[model samples]
Target chain A: MKILVFVKQVPDTDDVKLDPKTGNLRRDGVKSMMNPMDANAIEAALQLREKHGGSVCVVTMGLPMATEVQKKALGMGCDEAYLLSDRPFGGADTLATSYTLAKAAEKIGGYDLLLFGRLATDGDTAQTGPAVAAQLGIPQISLASSIAVEDGWVYCDRDLGDTVQRVRAKLPAVVTVNGGINKPRYATPINIMRAQKKPRTTWTAADLGCDMTKIGTPGSPSSTKKVFEPEKRNTDTQYLTGSPEDMARALADLLENEHLL
Target chain B: MKSDYQGIWVFAEQENGKLHPTVLELLAKSKELQKHNGEKITAVLLGADVSALADTLFSYGADAVLLCENEALRSYSARPYQKALTQLSEKYRPSIILYGATPLGRDLAPRVMVSLDTGLTADAIDLGFDEDGVFYQTTPGYGGKILAHIVILERRPQMATVHAQICSPIEPIADASGELIVEKLNIEPDGDYEVLETRSAEKSGESLAEAKVVVAGGRGVKTEEDLAMLRELADLLGGQLASSRPLVDNGMLPHDRQIGQSGATVSPDLMLNIAISGSVQYQLGMQKAKCIVAINQSEDAPIYDIAHIGAVTDYKKLVPALIAKIKARKQ
Candidate 1:
């Protein structure tokens, strides 16, 4: 079995700050980490490799700094890592991003299974995985809470909001794993040391032979016209101050007066 | 090409002969938009044995219902449903297509958009039309810090998926009349995926999305036991218990009870937040609650900015006290 996982480097959501002037994420001073769900994807891949005896490769499409996420994946027991970074790939929406990833997947051949995190923390679209599967013309199952492989089929427990379905897809398929699928193992000191010497590759749009018209901003059909903070409610908040008991009584009275109790 | 696309279309999602509430909500929203665009509101029904749902669609303001029935589509597998809907879009060329941002829609819409070579804005909070009648899909992105207004400039069938409970379903008209167009499409289920089993999750109480009141706890609640107190309060209020992402990530709560950008968006009549320092992500889910009460130890917690009432006190002490006070008042 050959498994490939897609990872992304996102600004740590807790510490992320926005540029007040531009209304954009200010990544200059913030730290980046593997998207939280992607960690689960990597763990799912590593677990599959452990059970099925195959190599696992992790790929990411972002700036040069995204190689750090690839390195992190390597430390976590992935066999290979690659970063698809190029100027032309910037400003790509879900469609263009998935197209570039599909081209990259074609370049890195021979994978029976492709895995992705359920959704990126930054984009929160959950569209790229299916879009990539569509671009590749392969079947996909998203929101897989659990996965297992047998007889060239990947069985997944899909979380469908109201119900959970056990679905199975044939080989050469795409699966996006949700968080809490498994507890991601921490990289040992030895693995972290060994990860520094592992082979990691970088590919640009030109190197991947991607169409210039379909790789970046020019290729993105939808673009954000403006990004603005949500309008805050303009109600006067009445603050209740005192001991816990006093405040509790005040709240009860307030709710009763307002007919909310 | 531009003139070919007519009417606003909605995917009427149903399962086990039951209609998803969001489908009715979408029909109501489409009815509102139709008043501006002067286009017919069409409901596209796809499933096995779902033709009887056409009347319900009509009552909810669908001018026409396009029924596509196939035994293979009895359960949504993404392939057959996408094929039928895509064929319909290609033939009728709807001016816009709306889908509920449920798990099935999120799974199926993107694939359909790919086949149709169009753009789909997912999880839209609101929809509007421009002067030239292009749809403006507004959605929260970047971890709910910003709202992105998206438009598909070149696509004939503009597509968008909306989160559930964002709009209310209109009252059904008793004598509503509409056309039921039962179309036949030759769709073979050729997908590589197979459904082995399906088990409905056992829900403990009212779901967070539909609850009239929501008592949500955050990391400030200290321990899992504290969450029980919140749950007690929710029960007392005849509502549901919810949590922010950290509690869910910490294994203190289930994913279904999480309220945030990645979790379920809830709009309740009253939201009592305990010890939650509101982040942009969590706020987006419950910001639409009719009234908000924040109880946190920190006086400066951002949740107070949006809350109608604020109590700066330890939840360990305050929650029990409030529970007692409400119990006493009930007596």
Candidate 2:
């Protein structure tokens, strides 16, 4: 089995803050980390390889700094990593991003499975994974909590809100894994040292034979018109200042007075 | 030459021959948007044994229902659903299409959009049409830190997916008149994906989304045992136990009990947030709760900004006391 995993570097959302005055993201001091869900995807791939005897290669499309994530994937036991970085690829929406990734995957062919995180923290759009599958003309199972491959068939447990469905797809399919699929293993010092010497390749848009017209913001049909903070509700907040017990009593009194208790 | 696309279309999602509530909600929203352009609100439905749903759709605001029934569509496999929907859209050329952002919709919408070579905005909270008649979709982006106004330029059948409960379903008009077009769809179930079996999780009580009172925990709840305390609190309050994404991701709670963008959107009458430092993503799910009581150790936690009552103290101490006080009151 040859598996391909998609990884992304996103700002640590917990540290991301909005400047109240300007209403813009304060990205100056925020650090970037591999999307938490992507870690699960990589871990799923690694586990499948361990069970079925295969190789795992990771791919990412972002700035040069994204290679740091590629290195981390290698550190986590992936065999190879590719970084699809170019200025022309900037601001690509899910469609264009999937186009670029599909083209790159075509170039890096001979893979039986493609995996991605359920959603990215930054965009929160679960579109790219399925869009990529559509671009590649393959079947996709999104929000997969558990997956097993045997006899050229991939069985997945999809996490629908109200139900858990067991689905099976032929090999050479795309699947997106959600969190808690598996506990990702940490990179030991030896693995980290070996990862530093692993094969890491960076490709430009031209290198992937991407049509310049369909590779970036110019090709993306969707555009963000504005970014603004949601309007805050004007509710009077009553602060109960005291010891823990006092505050508990006060809250109980408040709820009682309001007939909520 | 006039543009080919006309009328607003909604993908009326159904499972087990029952219409998902979000479809009617989208229909209600579509009816509102259609008034601006004076176009018909059409529903495109693809499933097995779903012809009987056309009347319900008409009563809910659909001017016409396009029903594509086939045995292969008995259970949702992405390829057949995408192919049917894509074929219908190409034939009718709708100006705008709406999908509910459920697991099925999130999976099928992107495939359909990609096949049509169009863009789709996911999990849109609001929808409207501009003076130029382009659809303006509003969705929370950047981890719910910012709202993004998205538009697809020069695309026919502009598409979007909205989460449930974002819009109210209007009262159905009795004996509403509408056109029901039955299309013959012949597709083999021979796809890359197949469903072997489905096991719906045993649900003991009301879902977190439908709960009137939600007692939610976060990463601040240190151990798995602590969730039992929160559950006790919830049980005493006649509510349900919910959690932020971290607790769910950490496997401290089930995915369905998660309250966040990727999980469930809950608008309860009261939200008791315990040991939760409210992140933007978590807030997006419960922001609509009529009253919020946040108890965290940090006074400056962002949850305080939106909470009606803030208690800066250790939840381990405050929660037990609050629970005891409530139990006494009950006595």
Candidate 3:
């Protein structure tokens, strides 16, 4: 079995500055990191590789600088790293994104399982994984909290609400992992040395056989009209007094008065 | 053409056979937005045999309910739901659409927005339209450090997903009526993804969102053993236990039990904040608590900024006494 883990390089949401003119997040000068959740996906894939004896290839779609992300994945025990970078792939939304990734996955070819974080922290949309599954015309299990392989198939325990949902899918499916699946492993010293020498193969829009018109900003349908900082809330807060009993009674009264009780 | 945008839409979120309360809340608020702006409130309900959920939608202020029922949508999958909703929004062209910021809604909304070529504002705390006919969606931005406003100027239907309980769910009126359109779906000719089975959470138990009394511990709780006191207090109050981001980081509680920005945003009736400094991230989660009581040794802790009752006593001593008082009241 061959496993491919999808990783994205997002601006450290902490470092991303708001563009005063466009109101969207400023991409320039912001430090970037592998989407935090994708680290867990890479970890899950490495464990599967160790147990199932398969090659793990980590893939990402971003700018040229994203080679650092691929290197990070390699250091974390991935057998190979690939990047699908093209200026045309910039500003692609989830729909177009899934299409481009599906095409790249087709280019990578012969993959049994695809792994993704439930959502990228920077975007927090949680749409790309399922969207990619839809584009690829495969089975997908999302928010997977635990996973195991048995009898030529995978069983996933997904956390939905308060209960764990046990789901099964055949091999060669896409799985989006939520947090707490497993603690991501730190790169060993030897692996860190090995990552620098490991060659990173790159793919462009043409390499993936994607339509140039729909690959990036041109293909994206949504546009950000304005982004202003959120307004501060200025509500009058009243502090209650006396013992617990008195405070409780006063609180209940306030709730009733506010008609919230 | 003055934008030609006409109506407000609600993605009526349903799980299993029961409808989510936040859907009704959106309807109520949508009705208010409609009344305020002379617009119409339309609801989109997509599920298997979900028309049954429509009757209540009218009472809650929707001018019409659009029902799209399909077994393919029996479980909440991003593919089919997004496909159907994107088609509906394009066809009818609502001016604004609202979704509850539940996991399902969060997943579905973005996918639909992607397909429709529109942007979405997630975790919006407040919403209203401006004089120029653009929807003003407000959300906590900058990692809870600041609030951000998003405006969809060129987009046809401005989209937003609000956390539940920020707005009140109004009781449905007895006699409200509009067109009931049953939309037929024509999804992508061939879909790549399929949902085999979905595990639904049991409907019972004290969910953090619905808990009345939430005893929350912060970094000051110190250790896992300290949480037992919080649990005891929660048990006495017939409530649930919650923790701030610090406790989650400390592994004292799981992420789901976390009550703050990165955790669950909840609006309980009574919340006890134990040794919490009330960072904006955590406050964003519990701002809806009806009566917030803070227990901290510091007099100027940020938790006291919004707390209705604040105690400067040490949580180590105050916790046991609070539990004892609740236990005595229960007996």
Positional deviation of residue A142's Cα in model 2 after best superposition, in angstroms:
1.3
Q: Each prediction's DockQ?
A: 0.56, 0.63, 0.23
| Superposed model 2: Cα runs more than 4 Å off | A15-24, A255-261, B130-134, B203-213, B219-239, B260-270, B275-291, B296-306, B312-331
- lDDT (CA) for every model shown? 0.84, 0.86, 0.74
- For candidate 1 chain A, which ten residues in a row score worst on lDDT? A10-19
Across B120-232, the per-residue lDDT of candidate 2 in tens digits comes to: 99888889876776679998765454676899878777899887777789999999979988899778785678887888865646788788889999878868678899999
| The candidate that achieves the highest lDDT relative to the unseen native structure | 2
Clashing pairs in 2: none
| Cand. 3 TM to true fold | 0.76
| Ranking of all predicted structures according to lDDT, beginning with the best and ending with the worst | 2, 1, 3
- State the local distance difference test value for candidate 2: 0.86
How would the candidate models be sorted by TM-score, starting from the highest? 2, 1, 3
Over B168-270, each residue of candidate 3 has an lDDT whose tens digit, in order, gives 8786678767689998886542244434555555443357987877889886887667888888877766778888765654345765787865367788888
TM-score per candidate for chain A alone: 0.91, 0.94, 0.86
Number of clashing pairs, model 2? 0
Tell me which residue pairs clash in candidate 1: none
Among the numbered candidates, top DockQ falls to: 2
Between candidates 2 and 3, the lDDT winner: 2
What does DockQ come to for candidate 1?
Answer: 0.56
